[model samples]
Target: MAGNTEPLSPRAKLAVTAGKAAAAVSRAAGRGSGSVIGGRVALKLDPDLLARVAAHLDVVLVSATNGKTTTTRLIAEALRAAGPVVSNALGANMPAGITSALAGGSDARYGVIEVDEKYLAGVARDVDPKAIALLNLSRDQLDRAAETRMLAEKWREGLAGSKALIVANCDDPLIAWAASSSANVVWVAAGQEWKDDAWSCPSCGGVLQRRDDDWGCGDCGFRRPTPQWALSGDYVLDPHGAAWPIRLQLPGRANKSNATMSAAVAAAFGVAPQIGLERMWDVTAVAGRYDVVSFDNRDLRLLLAKNPAGWLETFSLIDPAPAPVVLSVNARGADGTDTSWLWDVDYTRLTGHPLFVVGDRKLDLAVRLEVAGQSFRVCENLDEAVAAAPAGRIEVIANYTAFQDLRRRVGN
Candidate 1:
């Protein structure tokens, strides 16, 4: 409880120290290290602890900018279809977070950890997983992660000599480029289903032109690699069509990608893809990132939107023709670590009118909401926000820090 959950800034070293102490205690007990809310727990992880645990299971490291949690969560569930599975289920991609996950999963046969791009190198060396799934790279967290290109370069280097069976998303030009350089790669292309790959080519630095299923660089011929498996087919948007038809239950096109990418990773592990996918009975919405729950007899939807990519995707998941909607955002703790990233997000895409706003940083979110000319009602707290929410489904987009604190306060 004496740890610091600060951003990756001046308070990062303190976080590392707290992470080490907390880990050491968890290792000594040989059990899942419980979540610490107060600033009393320290997390100084024991190196020997991992060495002991690593001997029992084949670990899989899943890294990406957007879909790491969902994709890895899906894949870890899929792996369980084959046998017992282990994973860092609580979006703990950093070294200390992963250490806590491992300590928790001391008995698991396999581990699927969602490692952040920046933290991938350290985790790679620590866990040394047997498989890895590289979901995709996008622009996010400008304050924390500099640029997609820079992160990709670091990931490529970290994964340079990895022995894990690589399962990569071949849709993004940058990710596709990383997979090509990987030692053993089994690719999955997003194809015509995904949007916005109209940038430069990953191969020859040429401009890309979209052509149905493929996006190719006209000048140098860099195109999406032919994936081993694809989910490109047909869709009938009958106004009365099934919304939750897909077995995997996360909303939006990105969730579909996350689910399918997990299936592909399962196949690489020599298991039936479909069978593995079915094991994921439901989307694991633990805290933020689409965590739907009830509070005071009302449904509350909490999502983690860090940067432009996440904001755009979350916006995409919302139905434009719903019973209106409510949105709340905050940057109290780690949530609004650097509110500057708000500039990078594509707020224009959220044309879907919102009903209200809440959180400590509501003024900021309100200002943005106002600047974008979207309607919003402000509240001082989540309780007030929920109370103000219309008597129907409510939508909330709380960033990393806000989501956790909100969860505790709301008993989610």
Candidate 2:
């Protein structure tokens, strides 16, 4: 039987628990998430803490496969522009982490929390949000649990939802199905080319059909209508930029999605849509997520690619060609030992590039890189790889575990 643990009040609970958790984390290695081990906390039963927490303040829950963290920051910024808001600035989305964030921030009019897929149901129960912005779901963390569809089904079971107001990404079938299956959902979808490769029928495992950017499974006849609040067009940067006139600090279609999603949530919460977009326009870089830190007189731009999807997207912006590059991969409890997703990434595109690779699992990454016909210089660590990088346009792809060593060695 599930143990009945009377959920503590948000403030009281975090106050009592986080002292040891955060201190244990800080002491272990002076790093944040690495120190606070929450494996045991993720399990266990807690009551409907959402109503308890929401009674204290309005909460916004953000979740997605690829871009939730960066998007969460943008939403918080937009909401803060409307009125003072609080958030998990440290990028902790689980129950304990969210508790720590809530406990740590100012008691403000609003709150924004980014949540991981696995923890959503419980965290939703614990922090009953007034609104939720569901971004696209894709294949991620396969080793840890089930497929995206399976997780979608988990949310389908209610997952202790507030059902506040749903801001749904219509282009993503899973998000669309989940949101539309409920009432009071507002669809906020991207345009064509965004949903180019929609996921197939979750049940029959057949190809899903698309009508413009809106999609459905013809075989199963499950269709999610196109979102009404669409960020229809834009000024893409090029010889021909986006048709819109404003400058964007975060480049790429993905960042635009993040910015727009934030704006949409702000609108739902009664912030003037224009005001939210204006705040987003003033946005600059954050620390690790897609931050551009230059070194050696801007000869190289360092991007921290923590996960498989992140690496794939970052590589799209890079030449990975005649120019030399260093791809640092490692395993820490921080990055998780299951690097099996490396197999899912398209390493073939990287094979033709001049490369130097290093990390704890140097041989493993080297073999992965070599199998795609790439040539690589193997190093025992990051410092050696940094020292040996060819003097030209170079990039360093550092996974989460290897990033500390990358920072120490490259110092960018």
Model 2 agreement with the true structure over 278-342: per-residue lDDT tens digits: 67765565545445555544445566666666767767767547677778777777666777767
Deviation from native of the Cα of residue 232 in model 1, angstroms:
2.9
Model 2: residues with Cα > 4 Å off, grouped in runs: 1-29, 33-54, 159-161, 191-198, 210-214, 232-246, 294-300, 408-412
TM-score of 2: 0.82
lDDT of 1 by residue, 81-181 (tens): 66777677777566656655654554567778788788877777766677778877776555667567667767777778878777777777777776666
C-alpha lDDT values of all predictions: 0.64, 0.64
lDDT of candidate model 1 versus the reference: 0.64
On a 0 to 1 TM-score scale, where does candidate 1 land against the true structure?
A: 0.80
